[model samples]
Target: MFKHAHFKAHTALFLQATGLTGGPGAAPLFSGLDLQIPTGLTAVTGDEGTGKTSLLRLLSGDLSAHSGTRPATDALWLNLALPEHDEATPEQVWSALQQQCPRWSTELQQDVTEALSLQVHLGKKLFMLSTGSRRKVGLVALLASGATLTCLDQPYVSLDQGSIQVVRGFLNDMADHPTRAWLVADYEADPDLDWSSCITLG
Candidate 1:
C-alpha cells in the first residue's frame, strides 16, 4: 500500500527495474527502469508511438512488466480506450462502481458524483454522450472510486475545450483537495499544473 522513493519521500507507488515487451515476444518498451510516482497529479509525455499508453497500463496493474518491480499500490485503473458497455447512466456509473467495489462507501460515492457534477447525467446513455462527455464519465469513475491511485491514459484526446476543462478542473481539484495519487498521460500536459516531471520518450 505504500513505498519510498529514491529521495526517501514517502511514496504509495514504485516501478522498479520494470521491463515491458510489445506484441508477441517483441522488444521491450521499457527495461530495467525504476520509478516512484506520488499520490497526486503526475504527468507523462512522449511522442507518438512512444509506449506512453503501455506505461499507463503497467501502472494500472493491467499489464505485467517483463522484468523489475512496480510499487505495490492499491489502485483503481480506468482504460479510456474501448470503454465498457453499461446500460446505465453516468450517475449509475458511480453507484455501480460502489456496488462492485465493496470498499467504497455511500458517502464516498455521493461525494464523487456530486463533485463531478454528474447528477444530471444519470438517465443518459453511455453511447449517447458526446466524445467529451464519454471522457468525463471515465474521469468521474476514476476520481470517485477511492482506489488511492489513479492512472489515466490520454484522457483529453478527442474532447472539446469544455470537456477538457472539465477534466482539467477535476485534476486541479484533486491537487487542491490532495487525495490519492494520480498519473495522467496526455499529448501535451498543462503548464499550470506543474507537470514537467513527465518522462520524455523519443
Candidate 2:
C-alpha cells in the first residue's frame, strides 16, 4: 500500500488566468481559471496550442499570470522547452555546476546519469546531443536537485517508451516520499498515473 501524505503540509501550486504572449492586447492563455495544487501528480492536458506549456511555465513562475492568483512557489524552475547551451559539453556543464552553488553527491550523479543512460556521451557537446538526450539530462538533473516542485512541459515528446516509464516511476517515487509536487503537461494520459488532481485547458 502506498503511504499516505499530508497534503496540507505540502506546498501548493496555484494558477489563475496566466498570460503567455506579450504586447498590446496580448490575450491570456486561459482566463479566470483556478487551480489549487496539493500533492501527487497533476496533469494539464489539452490540444496543441491550448496553452498547456504556458500553464506549466506559470506554475513554475517562469511566466507570470496576467490577472489572477498563482500558487506560491518555493522552488527553482526547470525549463524543458529551452535547449541546452550549444557551447557547453555535458561534462563541462557538470564541471561548471560544481564550481557554483551545487555540489551533487558523486554517487547520486552517477546513478542519475546511468538511470538516464547518459554515460555514453558525457563528452559530447550540447549542440550535438539528440533532443531526447537533452530532455533526459535536464529532467534527470531536476530530479536530482533539491527543488520541491517540478513542472515539466510535454515531457513525453522525444522520450522512448522505457524512458517514459522511468519518468512515470520517478514521479511516483517523488510523491511516495512527499518530496515534490509534479505538474506534468502532456497530450495523452498514462494509465498508471495516479493523479491527485488534473487541470485541463480548453
Candidate 3:
C-alpha cells in the first residue's frame, strides 16, 4: 500500500490527433483524440486490437501518427516491448541503462532490483532466464528512471503472484510522486489499483 499524500496538479504529457491511422491499409485507431496526462496514475483499458498498445507507442514516440504531430517528449519513459538480445546478460543490460538513460537513479535501481528479486538472475544471459526474470530486468530500469511520464504496457504479464504484488506496490509508490505521471495500458484494469484517471480505448 502507498502512503496517501497531497496530490499536485501538473501536466507532463499532452497528446492530440486530428487523424491517426496505422496497420492493415492504414485504418484509423482514433480521430480527433486529445489527452492530457497530468501528474498521478492513469489507466488505459480496452480489449485486444483496441489500439491500447498503439496509443502508448504513439505517446512514447515509438510509433508515428499518420496525421497528428506530438511535441518532443524527451522526458517520457516507456517499457512496452523488449527486443530479443540473446547474448546479453541481465547484468549487462543494467550497466547499459546506467549509461543510456539520463534519468537513471542508482538508489531507485537498487530498491526496485531487490524488490523484484532480480539479483539471482543478474548473472544469467537473456536466453537462459525465464520470462519473468527477463521482464524484471526491464521493470527495474523502468522504475529506476526518474522521468516525468512513465508508461507501462501490460506490466503484469508473465509475472508471478509475488512479483506482481511487488510491482503493484512499486507503481503505487510511483503514483504518489509529485512530478511524475504513470500510465498503464492493459487488457483489463487491475481492481487493486487506484487509478486517478482511466481511458477506455477502442
| Candidate 3 global TM-score | 0.82
How close to the true structure is residue 121 of candidate 3, measured as C-alpha lDDT? Answer: 80
Root-mean-square deviation (CA) per prediction: 5.0, 5.9, 5.3
Q: Which has the higher lDDT value, candidate number 2 or candidate number 3?
A: 3
Error of 1 at 13 (Å): 7.4
For residues 26-65, write the lDDT of model 3, one tens digit per residue: 6666554656665668788888887777777777666767
Superior candidate under TM-score, 1 versus 3:
3
Ranking by lDDT: 3, 2, 1
Q: Write the per-residue lDDT of candidate 1 for residues 85-178, one digit (tens) a residue.
A: 5455776666677765545656755665565566777689777776666667777777667676678888777766765666677677666334
Q: For candidate 2, give the lDDT of residue 9.
A: 46
Q: In model 3, which regions exceed 4 Å deviation?
A: 1-25, 75-83
Better of 1 and 2 by lDDT: 2
Highest lDDT: which candidate?
A: 3
Off-target runs (Cα >4 Å) in candidate 2 are 1-25, 80-84, 91-107
lDDT digits (tens) for residues 1-202 of candidate 2? 1111223344354332232332123676556554566656767777887677776776677676666665565444455334546767766665554443253445666777887789887888777789898777666656665455667777767888888887888776666445357777777556687665666666
